[model samples]
Target: MGFDEVIPAPGRAWWSPVDQGAFVLDPGTVLHAGPGTERVAHWLRSTVGAATGLLLAEGRGDHGIELGLDPGLGPEAYRLDVTGQGIRVRGGDPAGVFWGAQTLRQLLGPEAFRRAPVDPGRREWPVPLGTVEDRPRFRWRGLMLDVARHFMPKDGVLRYLDLMAAHKLNVLHLHLTDDQGWRIEIRKYPRLTETGSWRSRTKFGHRASPLWEEKPHGGHYTQDDIREIVAYAAERHITVVPEIDIPGHSQAAIAAYPELGNTDVIDTASLTVWDTWGISPNVLAPTDNTLRFYEGVFEELLELFPSEFVHVGGDECPKEQWRQSPVAQARIKELGLADEDGLQAWFIAHFDKWLSARGRRLIGWDEILEGGLAKGAAVSSWRGYAGGIAAARAGHDVVMCPEQHVYLDHRQAPGEDEPVPIGYVRTLEDVYRFEPVPPELTEPEARHVLGTQANVWTEVMEDPARVDYQVFPRLSAFAEVAWSHLPAPREREFIGFQRRMVAHYARLDALGVAYRPHTGPRPWQRRPGVLGRPLEGPPPNR
Candidate 1:
C-alpha cells in the first residue's frame, strides 16, 4: 500500500487485492510486443526464460504479457497494469518499454535478476497484480567511471553497464585519458596506447614518502574493443560518453609524443606516463601539431562513440607551463587573447568547432568557463554546484556532479577504516538529498540543468570487486533521487527508502554484486592498492 516499498520508488504505484488474482507465468505464455517494443519484448523474453526456466514465447496471444507503445506517453515513461487475466505494459518509446521490463523484473522477485539452473520440468512465477505509472525526473541520469586512473577491462565495463541499466541510469561516462594512462587506441597515434598505456611502476607512498612497484602496469582498449563496448551498451539502452582529456592530464599523450607538449619550455623526454599522483605541469602546447593530434584522436573517438555528448576534460589545468612557454606566450598575443586562460579556451573551442561539425556536442569540465566556453559546449559542473548555476544562468546545459555530493570515491563514513582515504565524507544520504537543478536557478534557468551523476574515480581502486563495494547501495540510493520525485523534507522518506533496500540488497546478492555489506568492508575488500584509512582529494593531478 505504501510507495516506500519501491526502490527508486516509481513515480506512481499501487497494490491490488489478492482476490484480483495473479498471472502465473509458464513456458507457453506469450509475450505480445507492439510496434517499437519488439526489442524490449525479446530482451524480456530472454531474461524471464533465463531466470525461471520458462520458455516463454514472443508472440501475440489471448492470455499473456503485452509490451506496447503508447503514443501519448512522454519520454522514457511507461505504465504497467496487472490483473489475474494478464499483464500489460504501455511505453512512450522503446526505452520506456525497457524500463518497464526492468520494473517487471523487480516485481517478479530476486530470481528475475540471475540466470540460474532451472529444474527440468519448468517453473512458474506468480506476479502480484498492481499498477505503476513511471517516468524519470531527469533525462541525464548518469554514472561516470574514471577508467583512465585504473584501466577497467572490457568485461569489467560491461558488468558496470549491466548494473547501471538495472538501476535505470542511462549514461555511462567513460573517463578514458589522464596523466596516468591513455586507455583508448588512436590508430593515427599508435604510440598513445603502445607507449602511453604502460607505466614503469605505480606509486604506493606507503613505505617511503613515495614508493614505486617494480612491476610494470598497462592495458588498453583496441578500436575493435571499443566498437564491441559501444554495441554492448547499445543493447542495454545505455549511451557511452567518451572522454579524451586534453591540455591538462596530457602526460600520457606527451609521453607518447613529446612534440604535443611545450618542448621549448621543458625537456621532452622528462615526460613519461606519470607514476605518481598530482597534476603534471606537462600539457599539450598550443601548436598546430597539438591541435592536429587531438583532431586525429577525436576522429577515432567519433567513429567509436556516437553519443551526442563527448567529454573533453578541462578541469584543474595549471597555467604555469603556458605562462612560461615562449611559444604559448607568443600564440596568446597572436590570438589577441588576454592570458593563458584564454589560450585554454582556444584549445576547447578548437574541438568545439570540430565536434559541432560532426553534429556532436562538446562536454567539458567547469574550468572551460575560465576564459569563455565555446558556443555549443555543455558544461559538467564537478568542482561544485556554483559552476552549474553559472552555466545554467548563461543558458548552457549543465550536469551536476559536485564532488561533495556525488563523488563515490569520497569515504562513505569517517574515521580510519574508510578506504580510498580521500575526499570528505559523502554518504548515501548526502547523495540522495542532492537536487540536480540548483535552488539558485529560476524556472527557465533550471531547464538548462540536464541532471546529475555519481563519479567513481579509481585512483585507489585497482579491481572490479572494489568498484562494486564503493558504488552499490549508495548508487541505489542516488537512483531514487534521480528518478523519483521527493516529498518536501525527505528524512522520513529516506528511512522508508532504506527499508526498501533490504529487498534490493537481496536482489543484488542474488545477482552476484559484491556490494559493501551494511556492517563494513571485509579484509580482502581492502586489497594491496587500498587501505582502511581515508584519503582526501586526489594525489596531485596538479
Candidate 2:
C-alpha cells in the first residue's frame, strides 16, 4: 500500500459490466465489486478521468482504485476506496457516488490522468474513510447583485450565476430596483423602463463630484431576458429572487408614474445615481394609487419569477417625505396610524398579505425589523448579526449576512491602497472564520437561522473584473462557511484548511477564474498576543 510503488496507467478505458458485482477500472484493471453497478461504474470513470487529467498535467503517473461497501447500504451511503487498481466509488445513490468521485478527484493532482509514478510515503492522500451522512447546511446560501445602482449586462449576470453554481451556492438575489434605476421591464408601465431606467448624470469615484453628462445612461432586462435568466439559473439549482424596493427606493418608480408621488410636481427627474450613501427623500406616496401601482408591478413580478420568496426591499427608507406630506398625513389619519414608521409598516404589511394570498412569502431587509416584522416574513440581516438574532428570537426565519463579515464589496484589507472603501475590513480569513449561527442562540432558536449570503452592492464595483476581484477568495471562504460548519476562528484545523486551499486555488486557476490570492497569515497566527494594549500604529508616514 506504499504510494511510491504505484504507477498510473494513462491510456486505460473504464468499462462497466452487466454483472452488478465488479468493474473494469481501465481495460484489464479489475475492481472488486459493489451492488450498484451502473452508479459505481459512473463514479469510477469520472473519478479516473478527473484524476487522470490531473496527473497528466502534473507529470505524475500514479493511479489506483479501492472499494469497500457493506450490505444494506442506504440510498445515501457511498464508500470510496483508492488503491493501485484505480479509485472505486460505490454508493446506493448515483449522487453519493458522484460526490465520492469528486473527493477522489481532489486527492489526485492536476496531472492525475497521465502516466506517472505515485509519490510513495513522501505524499499521502488523506481520504476520510468513514460514514459521512451529509446534506446542505442551509436552505439558502445566496449572493445579492445590485443591478439597479449600475446595471450589469445580461452576459455579466450569467457569468455571476455560473460562479454561484460552481461553488454549490443555491440563491441569486437580484436587487432590481433603487432610486437610481428601475431595471425590470413592466409592460403595463412602459415608461418605468423607458424613462426611469435612464439617467443623465453618474457620479464617479468615491469622493468625485457628480458628473453631469448629456448622454443617457440606462438599460433594463426585458421580460424575455428575465425569463431566460430564470431558466438558466433553474437548470443550475439556483433560484433568482428578485427584489423591488418598495415604499422607499421608489424614486425611479415615482418618476415613471407621477401619480404615485405625493407631490404633483412634474419637475421630479429620477436620480441618475445617488451621491449620498444613506436613505433618499423621494419615497412612494402613501396613497391608494400607489398601492394599486405596486400591486400591478408585483403581478408582473410573479409572472416572471417563479421563486417562492419575493424580496420587497424595506431598507434605508427615511420617513421625512411622508411626515411632511399632507396626503400622507391624511392617509395616516384614515388608517389610524401613529407616525410614518407605522405607515411604512402598513405598506409592507399590505404586500405581505398580497404575496401571501398568491402562495408566496415576503422577504425584506433587516429594516423591516423596525415598526414590526410582517407575519411569516423572512429577514435578510445586512446591517449586522443583531437583526438576525432578533428575528430568530421572535420566531422568524433569518439569513445571517452580517456586513462586517459577509459584505463582499467591503475592501478585503484596511490599507488605503485597496480598490474600495474600507466599510468593514473583512479579509478572506475573516469570512472563513465566520460562524453563521450566533453563539448566544439556544439550540431550538438556532433552528430559525436559515442561511448566509454575501452582498455585492456594486456601488464602487463598476467593472466586472473588480467584482471578481472582490468576490473570490473571500467568497470561497463564505461558500465553505455557508455549506458546512467548521471549527472555531483560531483553530489549527482552519489553518490546515487554509493550506489545503492552495490546491483549491490551482483548480480555480485551471477553471480560468481571476480570484484574489490569499496572502496573509491564518487567523490563529494574527491573534493579539497581549490583551488591552493597542498595536503599534501604522509607521508615521515615511
Per-prediction TM-score, please? 0.95, 0.76
Model 2: lDDT to the true structure: 0.66
Clashes of each: 12, 28
1-542 per-residue lDDT for model 1 (tens digits)? 12235577898888765446677787767888888887887788677668887666866766688998886889989998877778899988888888988888887777777876445555677777888999998899899999887789999998888888889899999999999999998988899999999888886522122445667777999999999999988877889999999879889989999898898889978778988776788888999888987898899899999899999998888889889999999999999999999999999998999999999999999999888887689999988789999999898999988887888876777775765556767677777787777778999999998988888888767678778878877999888888777764345367667778888997798778978776776555444644534555433331
Please give the lDDT score at residue 151 for candidate 2: 85
**Deviation in Å, model 2, residue 373 alpha carbon:** 2.3
Which residue runs of candidate 1 sit more than 4 Å off their true CA positions? 1-4, 17-20, 118-122, 205-209, 489-492, 524-542
**Model 1 backbone overlap count:** 12
Which parts of model 2 are misplaced by more than 4 Å? 1-133, 207-216, 264-278, 520-542
Question: Over the stretch 187-292, how does candidate 2's per-residue lDDT look in tens digits?
Answer: 9999899878877655543322243334556689999999999988875567899999988887777777767766743335533334333356788888788889
